[model samples]
Structures are given as C-alpha cells and as structure tokens.
Target: MDMKRSLLRAGLVLAVALGAGHLMQKLADSRTHTAELATPQPKKIEKVSAGPQAAPAPSPAAPQVALAALTAETPKLPPLTLLPRLPVLAPPAAAKPAPEASVAPDCTPRLSLTATPRAMITLALNAPCAPGQRVVLRHAGLVVAERLDAKGQLSLDLPALDDAGQVSVLFSDASITTASAALPDTPLPRRFAVQWMADDSFQLRAVEAGQHYGDPDNVSTEAPVSARGGYLISLGDPTLDLPMLAQIYTWPADAKTTADPVIEAAVTEVTCGRDLLGETVQSRDGKATVTELTVAMPGCDALGDILVLNNLAGNVTLAAQN
Candidate 1:
C-alpha cells in the first residue's frame, strides 16, 4: 500500500508541469498578432510579360470647387463711400457804346449885287455886324472908296465898263466880293470926271461956245445942275480919314454946241502950299480915258486966290448943226 501511494503523487506532479507550459506558449503567440496589426507594410511590385496586350481605360479627374463655396469660409468687408457734384457758371454781359457830341453852325458875312438901267450896276451890301466900316469899290479901271452906313448897309450904282459886267468890292479886312452881269444898252453920252481928295480945293468949270461967266448955260462946281449945258454928279464922304471925292460932268446926248472944260484950283487951309493929286476920266464914243494929274498950289499967303489950269482938259468937239 505504501508504494502505490508514492507513485500516484509522482504522476500528479508531472501533469501540473505540462499544463503551465502550454498556457505560457499561448500568451506569447497572442502578443505577436497584436503587434503585426498596429504596423503597415509596403505593397509589392509585379513584372509583366514582353508580349503585346490590350490597355485598360483611365479613371476620371476630380471635379473643380466653386468660388462662393470657397469664400464662404472667409471674413466679409464694409461698403465704399461717394462724393457730391459741383455747380456750373455763365459768361459776362457786353459793354455799352458812348454818345456823340453836338456842334453849332457857322455865321459868315455875305454880299449881293444886281443889274440896273442905263448900263449900270446896283451893289447892295448887308453886314449887320460890321457897321461904319470902309469899303473900296472897283470896276474896270475905276476905284471908289466909301464907308458903310449906320445900319451896316450900302447901295450904289456903277457904270458897266464891260458888256459882261464884272465888279468887285474890297473890305478893310482884306475880304473881296465879286459879281457879274450883262449890259446890252446903247452907248453912254459924253462924260468928263474928276476925282480929288481935298473938298474945297478944286473946281471943274464948263463954258459953252458963246456963254459967259455966271450965265445960265455955264456949268461949275457952284451950279452942278445946269439947264443949257451938261450936269454934274458928285460922290464922296468927306467925314472919313483921307477921303476920296469924285465929280462927273455929263453932256446932253444930242448937243449941237461944243462945251469946253476948265479946271481951276483955289488955295485953302487944307491944300495950302502943297501939291494936289487927282485923276481925270473922260468917256466919249463908247470908250474911256483915265489920266493922273498933279497940280502945284500957291503959297499960304494967297490962300483965297484962284489959279487957272489951261492945258488940263483938252479941246472939245461938236457935231455940225444942219
């Protein structure tokens, strides 16, 4: 019985040792499988054959992404600001023109002339602003100096020297006025004229063929208008300074008796012991002759005495009576 018990204990010890060994071996194998699952391994490459074969279709590309969908994840910005507009301007206005000034009219002197009878001319002057002025009248070779009236007017008659009458007047201010006319009358009668300066120093004495001194047919300065012979016309303004004086003797157009002319000088206070100057104009047969004359005066002692000039006036002729 003792031997059988010892053999049973040995068998049990051998069985426990075998079971522990098997358990340790199974735990080691489980740890090795977990490690292999955590780590990856590289894929292996395979070689193809050298012969030709059909190729496979390629795979499609990936689709593109949209901008809205891309920017949806970015931050947003604020709106921009704007400025206001300015106003426009216009142009300036035009300038105005200036006005013109006014002027006055001119006032100058005027003269007029007209025709008259008997181959004469009528000169009329009107100078309202120039009164009492001296004026000289001229026609052909005859000149007469006179003065304007108190009314600044003058009217006179002048013998026409030309068929187409040409007359002129000269003023003291050196202004000249002229006129013209036509004279178609018959010839004038025989005339004798004498022009002198001193008033009472000279005398023209006319004596008919058989007339005596102081007779009705005698003509002299004292008796200018004679009934039986020629008449006399005197012209002058003695009040003027250095006056011009004239005397004319006109014989009848149908006279049968020859009338002689005699010039006499009487010494006076104004013409004492001085030479007397004068001009004589004789018109006959439609023609005229002008002669300048100078006469010597006596001494102042014989102031009232008369001196006769013989050769002053030439001889006179008359038509024979039937």
Candidate 2:
C-alpha cells in the first residue's frame, strides 16, 4: 500500500508540469506571429560613412580677343620729317664814344633866398661874413640888394614890382638866404545893378551893343540897342557864359531936372540868365541907399548873347551881362 500511494503522487505532478509547458509555448508563438504581421518602422537615428560623391559641373571658358584686330582699330599718324636749317646773320658793331676828362666841377651851396626887412633901404643879403663879398639880384621891375652879415639880417628891395601881386628880390646865389611872405586874399567879385520902381513898366525890346547902345526904358523906338561897360558885371567867366549882376539907383520923376528926395533903389529890369538875388547897399557917399541886383538868363548864347533892358526911363547905355 505505501508504494502504490507514492506512484500515484508522482504521476499527478508530471501531468501538471506538462500542461504549464504547453501554455508557455502557445503564448510565445502568438507574440511572434503578431510581430511578423506588423509593417517595418524606421530607426531613431542614421549615420553616414566615407563613400563616393557626385562630380561637379564643368565651367565655361572666357572669349578670346585678337591682337591684329585691336591694332587695326587704332588711328594712324603722319610721319615726321627733319626741318631745314637757316643762316643767322650777325649785326654790325656800333661806334664807341670818346673818353671824357675825369675832373668834375664843384657843386657847393653858398647862398639862399630871403625876405626880411620890408623897407628898401634896410634890404641886405644873408651870407657868410665876407666884408668885400659881391652879391647880385634879378627881377623884371627895378630893385636893389646888398650883403649884410654872417648870421641873421633884415632887408628888402625898392620898387618890388609894378603889379600889386608881385614882390621879387635878386641874389648872386640862391642858397645864401631864405624868406617867406603871406599872399593877399582874393577880392570879392564886382558887378553892377540896374533897377526899376514899382511905378515903372516896360517890355524886352532888342539887344544893345557897344558903348552908348540904347535907352533902358524905351523899347518902342527900336533904335540901336546894345550892351556896354559895367551894365552887367559878369559873375563867372564872362567870355564863355555871361553870368552877371548889377546895381542901379532908382530915380524920381523930377530928379532928372531938380533935386529929388534920397530914396532906396529898386532893381526891376535885369537880364543875365534869371533872377538870382537882390539886396541893398549903401551909396558911395553914404548919404543914400542903392539896390544891388543879381540875375541869370536862359543863357548868353540862348538869348543872342545880349541883354535888352526896358523900363520907364529913356533908353540908357547898355552893359554886358556876365
């Protein structure tokens, strides 16, 4: 009985072992079949190895230029030639001047000009002390000069000049003395004036010429009418343009034959160009008054170079306008 029991136990254990082995085999086969039916999957990474590469494309060649064709495009130039030589003539020699003496004349100052004593008798020459020294002077007018001393001395020549503007002295040498003088001032311009009173009236008649030309007031007669001295004093260069002035004393109706009251002169009739100004001046004797008239004309050439005076008085001597 003990042996039979042990055998039954061993059989049971072997059967169980056999069943477990079969189940594992089925599971492994099913897994493998499923894997085979699925599609292939790519790997997570790829690697490159040393291998051959594609060849590069060939490059095109550059176009070539021709040397002969380039030379033909250049411009041609003219050929150069040698110039002919010309003869150079020499000039004739000039004549030489003769040699002069080596000695030269002395040029030392010994005299000077002077103006000192205004009196003729006091006149003296200024020079180095030489008791018997000779002195000289030259002038158009008569004069006298003499030497005085070695230093300062005052002297003058007699009858300096006929002209008021001139004063001259003579000397042997100009360097012996020196002098100075103040020239006189220029005088005011001179002119004459003609006048007419408020009661007087007249028209421009005709021009008067020469001395004693015509009456100042009467132009109806038309006799010789012209200009004369001091009638119209030229203010400018009278020869070119007659710009003049005048001073005329008004006269009373009865003054010609009898004593008339002293009165102021009224310059009315004036011709030079046109009226410039009018003023009053004292009479020469200072006893009465006078009129100083200044006037201007269109032009001396424009007015026939003549002034026609017409007024109440009979025609008077004509005076040229400036």
Candidate 3:
C-alpha cells in the first residue's frame, strides 16, 4: 500500500508540469498575433484617373541593392593602361683630333731709299712683310710697283727723272721713304707749276711742260710774267704785258749774257716771284747809265727756255717757252 501511494503522487506532478508548458506556448502565440495586427500586409489600389498620375509613395525600407545588380546597372568605365619605363643609354666616345700645322709671325714691310739730287733713286727693302709681297715706288707722276722674293732683301734700278726733286717709295705697310737728288742731265723744257697768291707772290707745285694754270681771281699782277700768243695762258692771262726785271738762279758771270744787248733787251722772265720793271741801258760818252729802255715786244717762240740778262745793275734770269 505505501508503494501505490508513491506512484500516484509522481503521476500527478508530471501532469501539472505538462499543463504549465502548454500555457507558456499559448501566451507566445497570442503575442505573435498582436504584432501581426499592428503591422498589416499591403493591398493593391485601383487606378482612378488616366492623365499624368501622382508619383507613388516610397516603400518603408528600400530593397537592399545587390552588389552584382549595382555593378551590372552602372556604366562601364575606360580600361586603365600603364606606360612602360624607358632605358638610360650611354653617350658615344669622342674622336681623335688631327695634328696642327706651324704658323709664321706677322711681317710688316720697312723701306728706305737713297736719292742723289738730280739723279736716279735707289730703293731698299729693310723689312719684308710676307712671301710674295709687293713694293711700289712713285716719282713725279709715274708709279713703279714691284714684288719681292722670300728673302725680303730687294733693290730697284730706275732712270733719273729730274735734277732736283723728290721720289716717294711705299712698302706693303708703314714704311714710306722719300728721297731727293741732283742730276746734271735732267731733261728740259721741263714744265713748272705755280700757285700765285692774291699778293702777286707765287709757289711751285711741279716743274713741267705740263702746266695748265688753274682758275685764279682775275685781277692785275705786276709779276714778271708775260704770255706771247697763248703760252701758259689761263683765265685771260695774269702776267705783266711788258719787259720786267727777274733774277736767274746760279748765273755764271762769264757766260755771254746778251747776244744782242741793245735789241734783245725787249723781254720778260717769270721766275722767283718778282714784280715787273721796264728799264733801259744808255752809254753817253763812253760812260754807261741805265736809261729808259724801250723796244718792241716779241712772242715766247723767239727766245730759248732760259733768258739771261746780266748787264743791268741787278742780275736777273728769266724763262720763256720755245
């Protein structure tokens, strides 16, 4: 009897425990039903009007965008390309140079000349400018240009021009030589150039048969110059038209001065820039006195280049063109 009572009590306990579990389960179900009521499922609405319809409301939470779907919908981009790196190259080797040639120093010419008055000129090249260099010598109005050999030593042989004048020699550079000499056999009727001043004084530019007078102020001059039938005439002649006194340089006392003193006395000379004076030589009772000498004037052709008149108290030498 004790054992039966124990078994019935155990069965009652088991039944109570099962009833509690059933009640808890019913409560959980009730709570689930309440939540469902609070949030109802959506129902489709019927369209009212056709024209432009209002926009639909947004859903509570937008559907999560899938990574693959987003990637598919997005526009494709250009593919990226990387440039390759360049290599550093080495420079080329330098070439060998050629041997240089020797050069000479700069040589300038130096010249010297010796001229014996009235004789030819002697030229000497003291300094040689270079190989195959040239030198020039000028005299009167003529030029003599010559070249030198490698040695630079050179000499020039030329005929004499005038008894007393200048000769100019020029080298390739700086050295210029001027020489003067005297020669006994200088040719004449030489031409003489004259520069006359307003005061009737004159200067010699050149001695020539080549003198053609330049334009001078047309005024009267008392100088001992006369033109006979157009000799040395320029700008209507500016010489004395009568016999004038003039001095002759280096006149010997012994030479027969007047071939015919009385008749040849009617003359004029142009030299040494002296003015004119008409004079006479008179001898009364074996005594000579200078009287007023008058005679007929003759042209230039009648007399020689040299007109020597010595009997007068003053000695003067004159020149005329024959």
Candidate 2 segments whose C-alpha is farther than 4 A from its true place: 1-14, 41-322
Q: For model 3, how does the per-residue alpha-carbon lDDT over 54-85 read when each residue is reduced to its tens digit?
A: 79987799678777544546777899897887
TM of each candidate vs. truth? 0.57, 0.17, 0.23
What's the TM for model 2?
Answer: 0.17
Predictions in order: lDDT = 0.68, 0.34, 0.40
* Candidate 1 lowest-lDDT run of ten: 313-322
lDDT of 3 at 253: 22
The pairs that clash in candidate 1 are none
Off by over 4 Å in 3: 1-108, 116-118, 163-165, 172-177, 181-322
Q: Which candidate order results from sorting by lDDT in descending order?
A: 1, 3, 2
Worst 10 residues of 2 by lDDT: 229-238
Report the lDDT tens digits of candidate 2 across residue range 1-322: 7787788777777777777778878888998888877956666667768688668876877888867645646687888887887777778678788888686533332333333232111234434334423343332221223343444233443212211223333334544332323212322112112322222211223222221323453212232212221111111111212212222222222222221111122233344235544432322211223444343445434543443333313323333433
Residue 262 deviation, candidate 2, in Å? 13
TM-score-wise, the better of 2 and 3 is 3
